[model samples]
Target: MNTHNLIVGISGASGALYGIRLLEACRDLGVQTHLVISKAGEMTLHHETGLAVSDVRALATKSYKIADIGAAIASGSFRNAGMVIAPCSIRSMSEIATGVTSNLMTRAADVALKERRRLVLMVRESPLHSGHLATMKTLSDLGAIIAPPVPAFYTHPTSLDDMVNHTVGRTLDLLAIENNLAERWDGLKNARTRSQENDGGRD
Candidate 1:
């Protein structure tokens, strides 16, 4: 498959692992990633994931300083398949919602929205307040997808990796990237049918 250019942003969320997983997945798929990490994200990367900034940067094909507004991805002319803000923080979401391109992360997202490209925000906050909801609504109206890193229990996940993979898989699905990170409901249809058959036979 031809490599597609993807813009990935890491914000100051508790789950930095999602961004790391996304980077690894993109690298494995031969996708070129333009990565940016917010200042808060840099601290969180070390605090939460215990990964050095340089180590994290090594995962992506290209890295850019978040404050660098002159980055290629900050312009609409630079073509990209899409942009994803994995573990997107509420602060970052507000920035994107308000068109504040102070950093490359938000600037890339702004370019994606203006260029009519897929802009997926994997917001990672729990028990959100009204302000957060309002920001999400604003972004939704601006054609940005506000997806949270909610886990899917229907897959009967047995490990932390399973949960993370499921969420990341759904994010990729939204971006139209085909991947089998977790089993779908279709795979359980036959098992459900067989269980029903056994119950009926016992009755």
Candidate 2:
């Protein structure tokens, strides 16, 4: 396995920034990222961030086309640390869950599952119905981590970037990558103490 390599998938989802932030974080940490973006992903990336497809592709160590099922990351033998589908769309998640992948992104995810590698799907949907929940359950049963990008209030995010960084940092933690992009929770006692200290100074 390539200990320094990580497979990244970006699908058509509302939170395209999550995928971009993940790639930037990995790049900062010196991790080699193998990226694959779906057609809808490209559209969303542009619509949401106004970033060109080539610009996003330049962020990764390597990039693959969605139709390239023969790509190295599509094979279990490719040997990477694991795979992460940031801003994973419901359709993409369903494809992975059912093993009915239509593109290299989902194909790579399926390969990750078959290889017993950590597959983190940052599902980006809200007000999920029973069918969506069932699909998530199925993916979980098959060894995929259904980690929705739920914000952490404890992080006390003052801006959108903070929230994105926190979520991406937590996801990287799941991938076993060390990153200081987000503030770490020390303890409740420490938090209270800090709060009290600030209050004392305020008065």
Candidate 3:
């Protein structure tokens, strides 16, 4: 496989763990990640996830200042396979929707959209207002995938890590990276077969 490149951005949202999990998954897959974190993201990471900025930085292959608009990833010709904005905040969503490339995160997203590469925004807010919905629509119309990080209970997640892995795994799927972070429905076939055999014997 060619070296799949991903641009990951973390914004001020409640779920910093999602981003961290995503980074870990990408690293394990040997995908080169260009990471950017907003100022509020740093604050949220500390307050909610109990992760220091240094620790978060350690997860990524490379880290860029959000204000570093001149970064290679900020350009359309950067040749990245895709971009993902994990735990995307409403503010960041609106900026990308309106084509405001103020920072490296938004700029890289804009580049992804323009380049027609996969751009998955894991919007984390809930109880959306008209403005937020409208922004999502706008980005969607521009070929961006607005993936809200809604939990999947059907997976029978046992802990917080399971939930985080499921969402991050789906995000990786969107980026076309193969990962086994979450259990797939097809894997249950063997269990179903065993259950049927036991029921037959009992009958």
Candidate 4:
């Protein structure tokens, strides 16, 4: 498979591990990643993951400061496959939706949409107000995929890591990247196997 370059932004939202694991999955798939972390992201990184900014930057192929709008990633000509904002805050999402990027993180996302490239927002808010939902609709209309980091219980995830990996894997699928980070849904694979075995008994 051809190598894909993806831009990842970690906003100030909780569930910062989702962002960290995304970088790790990109490493496993050999997907070159350009990562940007906001000021709130930096704080949440320490608050939630207990990891320093340097440690998180170590996971990406390239890292950009939230203030650096002049970075290559802030332009459409950079030609990345897509951009994902893991645990995207409502403020960042609103910024992207409104085309008013006050920082490099949302600027990159705006570039992706303007370039007709994939832009996935892992919006990490709940009990969203009408304003939030409207912004999401505006983004969706603009071809940005709004994804929340909700776990899939049907996969029978045995641990938090399992849930995280599976959710991230599924999210990356939107970018058309190959990943075996979690078990895929095969329309009840085990149940189908059991049914076939039971039928074979009649033979």
Q: Please state the error at residue 85 of candidate 1 in Å.
A: 0.4
Worst 10 residues of 2 by lDDT: 194-203
Predicted structure with the largest TM-score when compared to the true one: 2
Tens digits of lDDT, candidate 2, 28-100: 8889999999999999999999999999999999999999999999888897999999889999999999999
lDDT of 1 by residue, 1-203 (tens): 22789899999988899999999888887888999999999999999878899999999999999889998999999988899999899988888888866789998998899999999999998898999999999999999999898888876677999999988888888888777775667767775775578679452
Question: Cα lDDT of model 1 overall?
Answer: 0.88
Query: Compared with the true structure, what per-residue lDDT tens digits does model 4 show for residues 83-158?
Result: 9999899999999999999999999999999999999999999889999999999999999999899998876677
Question: How high is the lDDT of residue 49 in model 4?
Answer: 83
Candidate 3, residue 147: Cα displacement in angstroms equals 0.8
lDDT of 3 by residue, 120-196 (tens): 99998879988889888899999999999988876667798889899898888887888898667666777566557
Off by over 4 Å in 3: 187-203
C-alpha lDDT values of all predictions: 0.88, 0.91, 0.87, 0.91
Clashing pairs in 3: none
Query: What local lDDT does model 1 show for residue 108?
Result: 91
The 10-residue segment of model 1 with minimum total lDDT is 194-203
lDDT of 3: 0.87
